[model samples]
Target: MGHSNVSNFVLAVTVPLPSLLFYLSFVQKCDGDRWENEYWTWVCDWGRLHPLYLVNVLFFLNVDILFWVVGLVQQNVWLIDPYWTIIPVLIAHFYSAYPAAQYDLLRSRAALLLIWIWSARLTYNYFRRELWQWGKREDWRFTDIRRKDPRNWWWKSFFVCFVSQHTFLVGITLPFYSIFTNARPWNAWDGLAFLVCLSGITIAHVADTQLHSFVARNNILKDLGAPTEPLLNRGLWHYSRHPNYFGEQLFWWGLSLFSVNLGQSWAVVGTAINSACLAYTTVLVERKMVQEPSRADVYRQYQKSTSVLIPWFNRSTLVKSKTS
Candidate 1:
């Protein structure tokens, strides 16, 4: 078969097969004790000790290996970008539907609703940014990396793209595991988490919308052979250089609160790691912005006046610094 056909076949089988098996073997049974075989029982026992192991295995097979092979075949390592908005919702539902899941119905339902909202917003933004084109372009960051080391990128991408995502994506969703495992009643903490998540979603939506409009206008300007704006400095961008990122961080941290409500504070580690990764990404993005001849000086000045990731009043531009 052709390379495209081969990759399609792999995607078709691997993506749903593990999830189907998991549902049939475990979720459908609804009782772990019913497995009579010693081997199945042993597997169940191990799964309980490492509650995330089964899901991790599913991700490894479905995403890590599947995407790596597809990337190699297609010569496009951007397969995971769109899926980033999707996988968390799947993970949340998986946990909620797990045979051993014992979460409070209200809390689980609310969490699921919030996740769906977040997913919808992000997925819409991604498609909007792509002008509704599917796989028309890869993210600039990945393109840059591939350009730097084209010879070894195929192998290196497995580690750089898939494996690193395995860490961040799985880690950030750890709270879902905690929430499903615990049967704690809905409380004030859950309310707080919901509000924070809603707020984050709103902020991210507004920031992304403004940025998208700005980019579209610039494209029009470019087409007309007119000078485009140097940078977006209005709305949320006026207060923070990356309000969308700030909003995303808030959403994850808010999700972590659900685990905290269940007294499993350790789940916050995932959100913390996600934040650290975002901070590093922010630095990279800012450096790239500064490299642009058209926008470097303007962006640098904006950086001096604006918060990096959080919304705050801009510093007074008139306040002269010692260096100045």
Candidate 2:
């Protein structure tokens, strides 16, 4: 409690939750045409949609319960980060398995491939930080929130962190469901969606790589008894305070495009809400940067001079140009 050790837990806490969710949803139910089983008739009660909808809800609810229990017992609320990285893959693969009359398998394949690439990059980043190692802990953002209200942090973390993330996951994944069901042939719109998604993935990869390099260099400097530098302002960091976050938000919006082009216009609601959530996340992260003792002043300048999330023309450079 004196100093928050963010990364100090076993991989057991992180790995099993998603594996269990997958087992419950896909593996366990895969015994010989279970969807056609008669039990769903009673449970679904002749709803237009199948019982898998209910299963999906229960699956997430189970996930929440698991998170809350693990969070309370381990006293580590950071366990959910890995799940965040992989949930999209789970949702995409799950929905894509359901049959459609003229199912665009190619489109689903493209979406899944892009999502997997995104997932792989994020998961690698998480592991590279040694978060999967025992004693490795949660992100500082969650730790800071807990520190703010220690007495009530347990319940607050449950609702604010776990529940909020669950809601966002569900909302953001709606388009995947739409894409799976809509069997429209590949068109120019699909091509556009593919290009947008590819762009997002590439942007995020570059941003993450630049960030990792900066952090590693700083660590090396600190270890060698040299002066550590200020926050990163080069590469993608120069244009936006959170280029990775911007790329992530754009990626989801691009996925939403597939649904929209397929004529599921309502899917835009999910994309819009998800975008707002990412914006809120950016605000929270910036708030943390402004409050940190070491980072506050320098980060304040960065925040003032750079776009908060979007990558726009560098304001600092523009000002320097005008001044000269």
Candidate 3:
């Protein structure tokens, strides 16, 4: 048990350390620094970079530490939760060489690899692009926090924002770890889980494609003397203001299939956390996407018409539809 606990801590630190170092190194260039920094210059700029990024990086890194430490105490298996496919899924499942020893490490590793590739691609794309924006990019959510607080409270706002994002990211991964560690031998549950997760990923891709296409067409129209405004209704988006968010929740919920116990003490809690995290996405990420007064009603109408997380073929009150 002692050994396992230590292993958990070490595992948690893996991604966090690299991410912290990478972001910190990159952010230093935010201030009027040139694209290139000499060896010693790197260290100096890091010392002078925005404390906001530093605080967030530390908070994220510590979260990694806390998870490993908690795994030790609760006997929680690290990177084997069996609930989420975000990060741990790839590490524990696809890379497990000792299939016979670990019971099905090979299969798990394959699944993990697939999930990791998909999620890593998406997350890196989203998070890194935001960082690349430098001051031009403000995570819209941060603007609200900044406005709600006075200028003097920027530090507190920074702390809150950084902690919230870090913690939320951690929560997103919790379900997968729970599933892998607790559930043994893939059963019928695995198929269900796979379908759900795949569905989510596929639909999210579709939504993103459609959104970009819509914008591109509008850009062309604008060039032709008409602006293509923000698309609130079209394709899957017409069904729900946020099909992508729904897909995200569905994917995590599916991943949780591996770890859930219909009656385990943590079973319900894990499910609830997975569900709540999706809700948080809707409230935090989706609601703020629009600002026009005229379109608010359309958004509200679409929200009422569509299923929030579950997919449906069309707008139906009896069932949730993904394709509308």
* Model 1 lDDT tens row, 1-324: 456545544564465566657755766544656776787677776765665888788888878898888788878876788789888988888788776678888888888999999999999999888766555566787888999999999888888888889899999999999889888899999999999999999999999999999999999999999999999999999889999999999999999999998999999998999899999999999999999999999999999899999999878543545337
Give candidates' CA RMSD values in order.
3.9, 4.2, 15.2
TM-score of each model, paired residue for residue? 0.90, 0.84, 0.58
Please give the clash total of every predicted structure, in order.
0, 10, 27
Candidate with better lDDT, 1 vs 3:
1
**Global lDDT of each model?**
0.85, 0.74, 0.51
Candidate 1 structure, TM-score to reference: 0.90
Q: Pick the candidate with the highest TM-score.
A: 1
Of 1 and 2, the candidate ahead on lDDT is 1
Which clashing pairs does model 1 show? none
| Top-down lDDT ranking | 1, 2, 3
Weakest 10 consecutive residues, lDDT, candidate 1?
4-13
lDDT of 3 at 214: 75
How would the candidate models be sorted by TM-score, starting from the highest?
A: 1, 2, 3
For model 3, how does the per-residue alpha-carbon lDDT over 131-232 read when each residue is reduced to its tens digit? 322122334554455568656343454344434444554445444344444336656766676777788777776776666667668769989997556544
Per residue, candidate 2 scores C-alpha lDDT tens digits across 88-107 of 78767666654321358788
Better of 1 and 2 by TM-score: 1
